[model samples]
Target chain A: MRNVKLTVAYDGTNYHGFQEQRGTGLATVQEVLELCLGRLAGRRVQVTGAGRTDAGVHALGQVVNFDAAGWPIPVERIPLAMNGLLPGDVVVTEAREVGQDFHARFSARAKIYRYTIWNNRIPSPFNRLYSSFWPVPLNDEAMSQACDHLLGRHDFKCFQASGATVKTTVRTLYRAEVIREGTLVHFVFKGDGFLYNMVRIMTGTLLQVGMGKASPDSIRNLLESRQRAQAGPTMPPQGLCLEHVEY
Target chain B: MRNVKLTVAYDGTNYHGFQEQRGTGLATVQEVLELCLGRLAGRRVQVTGAGRTDAGVHALGQVVNFDAAGWPIPVERIPLAMNGLLPGDVVVTEAREVGQDFHARFSARAKIYRYTIWNNRIPSPFNRLYSSFWPVPLNDEAMSQACDHLLGRHDFKCFQASGATVKTTVRTLYRAEVIREGTLVHFVFKGDGFLYNMVRIMTGTLLQVGMGKASPDSIRNLLESRQRAQAGPTMPPQGLCLEHVEY
Candidate 1:
């Protein structure tokens, strides 16, 4: 059996999420990709993505893998063929053959995400779909100071959404920084793994520091508290993007 | 009587064009501005714009003028008030009382237009609405060489689209250049005025030169010929943007 890995890019504005729901009838990136892959493979095909991004979250370098044992088409040509069948919002950018044991999700070592905020009095029409508009002024220094508390290993229970249940609340954050480019403020995070809505909650908390609602050094207490209510509100999904997956 | 000049910005994706159609029932930028101005003035209002951009063309600094003889609101407060009534796609960025004799169109010394081309194999989800995607390898040198021939005054009837009647086909191009930034190729043109579909056609011809379909110096012959049939096809309007209007 040949394992085929695909690098995908998609505008998730019209999608429910990355995962395939059984009977929701709502469009999703996974289902659309599986449908196209099935057509190319001449059989039912299941795709395993590196991460399940929330609805309205975009991705520039999402990774996925599928078994193409019986497929007649070469792995190199898969991207071109599948792009023809996929919707305009989703595109298969690169495809390659991998080891039989290679897995899309389990084999990932790290993932980088970027959250964009348009900090302007008036929202720009060009960035409406991709960025979250925040009219208030943001203190970049305060936000950066808050980001310093998030680096390295930590119990991120306070930043995680309440509904999800996981075996452990611990995760390793490799890098966390806030960068400002013109009117756009980018919050970039690279981690071993992220809990449900962890990045969004962290972003909201950092923004609160920028807004003077919270102290920059308060993140240490929030993380130690392990209470979801102690963290800031969850930011919206539209501003989040899966930037890259490092194997 | 007061002549109020306003700086406008709009994402023209949803509108038919900047000019209002008599009976087409199509929404336009002018009509929307007039509707809001009329509401603020408590009477019918007409707006004259510096440039009548085509459908799907964006603008960042489009200038417009309207007489506000009996308007109750002060000119400085017009933008805030009009913005409340304007749609999300259109925005009145700045409003001020101008000289009575100042006209939006006739008093303009030059206009700057920018055309963006995504010259890469993989399309960018963020720039899809703002740029034209062309996967083929473009020779930037050839395109720049072609731009050299289009500088200064010339009878550009070949670059002008048919069905537009004007007193003279000669127009002065103050600046014409092609710049490459990473995967994006930007064509910037500053001119006294552009004929209908003139910029789009010129872009198409330059792209043809880049593609090796036409020679770099062929633009001189195309201009001297004054035959629209000899020019390249008109590019789509979505890639065109009215960057600024200079007085």
Candidate 2:
């Protein structure tokens, strides 16, 4: 059998999420990819994604893999062929053959997530779907100072969403930074692994610091407490984007 | 009686157009604005727009004027109050009281229209709703030369859509230029007035010249012929945006 790896991008506005739910009758990114791949392979094909993003979360470089033994189309042409059958919101950007043992979810070394905020009194019409609108002035210097506490390895239990069943709450954060471009603030995080809603919770907490509601030093106590209640509220899913995954 | 002028912005993907039709049941930007104004005024109100954008055409600084006599809300607070009732896609960026003689359509000195082309092989998920995707390579020099021929006053009958009745087809062209920004090509036009579908049709002809299908000198003949069939096909409405209306 030939293993095929694909890099996908999607708008994620009309989708339920990345994972497929059998009994819910809801559409998902994985289900759409599987449907298109099965059509091209002339049989049922199951695909696995690198990350299971929440509903309304967009992606620029989501990775997925599937096995096809007797597929007629060449590996390089799979992206074009799959894009023809998929919806306009979802597109396969690149496709190639990979080793059989390279699992999409297990072979990932790091993931990059980006959260966008429109920091202006009047919200932008073009950025309505892709960014969260914050109508208050933010101190970028304070937000940057808060990012220093989130760097390196730590127990991120305070940032994890409740009811998530992760085996461990400890993860290594390779980088954390806040960038401001015009009236837009971008919170970027690169980590070895992330728990459910970790990036969104972290963004909310940093925003609180930027707005002067919390001090940058408070992050240290929150991380040490290891309690979900100590962290800020979870930001909306529309502002979050899975930017890339490195293997 | 107070004459209120509003500078509006909207993502026109879900709207039918800027003008309100009597028999058609489709929702329009004008209809929505009037609905909110009437609710705030406790009486029926009508608004006149500077330009009548086609279906799926966006706007950044569309100007509109309405009469508000005996209105309860202050003129400066109208934008904030109306925004609370309008949908997320449409917003009134600025509102001010104007003279009674100031008509949004009649007193306009010039209008600026912008057409965006995604000049790349791969379509972007973020720009799907705003730009028209063109995969082929275009010669920017040829498009610039074509724009030069369209700078002066001329009869634009060839650029007008069929069945559009206007008092005169002769109009003054203040400026026309094509600018390339990264993977996007912007066609900006400023004129005293534009005929029906003039901007879109002119953009189509310029794209033809850039693609080597036509020569830069052909525009002169196309204008002199005064025939709609001699011009290139009208481009789609999604790429056209009413950028500004100058008094």
CAPRI quality band, candidate 2 = medium
Local accuracy by lDDT, each model: 0.92, 0.93
Query: On residues A70-89, what C-alpha lDDT tens digit does candidate 1 reach at each position?
Result: 78998888887987788878
For every prediction, compared with the true complex, DockQ reads 0.49, 0.70
Highest-lDDT candidate: 2
- Taking chain A by itself, what TM-score does each prediction score? 0.98, 0.98
Candidate 2 chain A weakest lDDT stretch, 10 residues: A79-88
Screening candidate 1 with a backbone cut-off below 3 angstroms (N, C-alpha, C), the clashing residue pairs are none
Candidate 2 matches the true fold with a TM-score of: 0.98
Off by over 4 Å in 2: none
TM-score of each: 0.95, 0.98
